[model samples]
Target: MQTTLMIYDGTAPADSGVPRTGGVPLAPAGFTWPICGSSCGGPLQFFAHLPVEDGVLSVFVCQNDPGACESWDATSGANRVYLFPREELQPVEAPATGVTLLPATSAIRTHVVTLDPAEDDDHDELAPDAYDLARSGWKREPEERFGKQREVLGSLGGSPSYLEDDRLPACPACTDTMEFAAHLEEGISAQSAMNLGGRLGYVFVCRACREGAFLTD
Candidate 1:
């Protein structure tokens, strides 16, 4: 059975240039994703994703003042979108409805497209299985849903890479959100039992506000 997933796309504030979206709460973390690093600019919000074409890239905007780094224009160059193979996507079980994220195989071919401003987002005609795959990559599937604690902890070796859906940090100075700066392939872990899967994401602070961002992979 295929399940569906919900993903968000939004821009970071001018001070912090971290792009972000909403996700199911993960206990202590509350409403947040990975912060890239310090020296990020402003706060970022989740807007929407590009269409299935051209790799299904997600889009984020910079709501900072024009006087700031003008991240809105700078962010145009970022590879914010991603496309995943059908096998890599996962079906999340909704506790309330008991319905999975992807209800059918059609979800594997799904992609998202977000319009601007976000104030008027309406999926009136969208099917129930849209946004089935939240993360890409072969390893992301089991790790995200069923990977053991040790798997996530011990796997944090080698290079580091940022996940397309990570919640980057916002700027502290001007409060603009930061953008996806770069990905890290390798990373180290604190303990063997602390595996969130070997893969990890790194977000950077916005260049304009110098705030911190988060990373994911």
Candidate 2:
């Protein structure tokens, strides 16, 4: 299976327009910073800025009260995903209060990884999850296992890792099942990672409707 992994490339300018996590989000003019519509009702924390084929995927989640707001559910209103046009996007002004951004801006670079099906003799024993396999095999050196795993910012394109069928989100605009867009890891460093309560973040989008969804698992 072929999986495109997003690797950390150190710090980047907040509005560099490159694929990254943290930093201020770039949006069209008149764009207002998203606020959590769930329980906390505070400004949502910016999670990522991902450049995709058609546009950029801007993500946000409520950090005001993690578990209390249900940011892990796509339709809960505590999280949001937007597919913004690549051009004409400007850095958005952040709110004065709430967790609106991470402590550091993390740059990302993509690496395509192909996992040979023939390499595993126990393939039949377990259902293969491409994202998990790719992440486990991302080490640069044989002994770099755990350390290298931290460098994985997430992935660009691939099936959702271990996501259940029913958990797939429906596009808010058209009510159609959204296509999997990306998977986001917490981050490279504990201090800079988006607070996900130790779970993985999932992004989905409906190209036809230009809508997106965010959830955690």
Candidate 3:
């Protein structure tokens, strides 16, 4: 069965040139850089800094040795998602080199959508490069359902919070069940987008463990 979901997209903020890989938090005080998984033994790649009504959502991922580290496994300790309080938010220090932070702070509106075949069939069954396979048939259709809202994150709703349910990941830190944190799709352009391997990246966070996970499919 093909389940339909309404997702949203909006303009991204201008780049501030802060290197995201192993970058500091946006908060002015009382925050530290999130630790990458055991695979890297170093800092994770800063993905995005999304601001919402509640607070700022900071994201990080592991791009080092992506082809070898089971990078798509949510529990692989390759990703981190943090929801920081806006009151304590501040600018982060940029690094000298490497990929920098993504521009997504100004999420203005939402766009609702539904797919013809759910776009992710055969989800439970493991397939090589399953994430890419699931989205292979994607195309821009004129009939795409659109809506407007103030939602930034959590605007899209579905299994595992607007993503495929089977793609739900566990917390690598505690081996406990994880919860959906955000849904990352392609952006308007390359400079300010989440290049999620041409598929949707589902971000999960184990609030209990203070750990995060990421997967794309």
* Highest lDDT scorer: 2
Which parts of model 2 have CA positions greater than 4 angstroms off? 121-124, 140-147
29-92 per-residue lDDT for model 1 (tens digits)? 1223221121234333222221221122222222222223333222222112222222233212
lDDT of 2 by residue, 113-154 (tens): 998866744457778888887887786565553437898988
Which wins on TM-score, candidate 1 or candidate 2?
Answer: 2
* Residue 15, candidate 3: C-alpha displacement in angstroms: 7.9
True lDDT of residue 53, candidate 1: 18
Candidate 2: Cα lDDT at 168: 97
Name the lDDT of candidate 2: 0.90
Ranking by TM-score: 2, 3, 1
The lDDT values for all models are 0.26, 0.90, 0.51
User: What tens digits encode model 3's per-residue C-alpha lDDT throughout 127-162?
Assistant: 323223222323434354332211222232234433
Clashing pairs in 3: 8-111, 20-46, 26-90, 158-162
Q: Which stretches of candidate 3 lie over 4 Å from their true place?
A: 1-25, 28-30, 38-42, 51-55, 64-68, 103-108, 111-155, 161-167, 172-176, 206-211
Write down the TM-score of every candidate.
0.22, 0.95, 0.58
What's the alpha carbon RMSD for model 3?
A: 7.4
Q: Where does candidate 1 have its weakest 10-residue lDDT segment?
A: 99-108
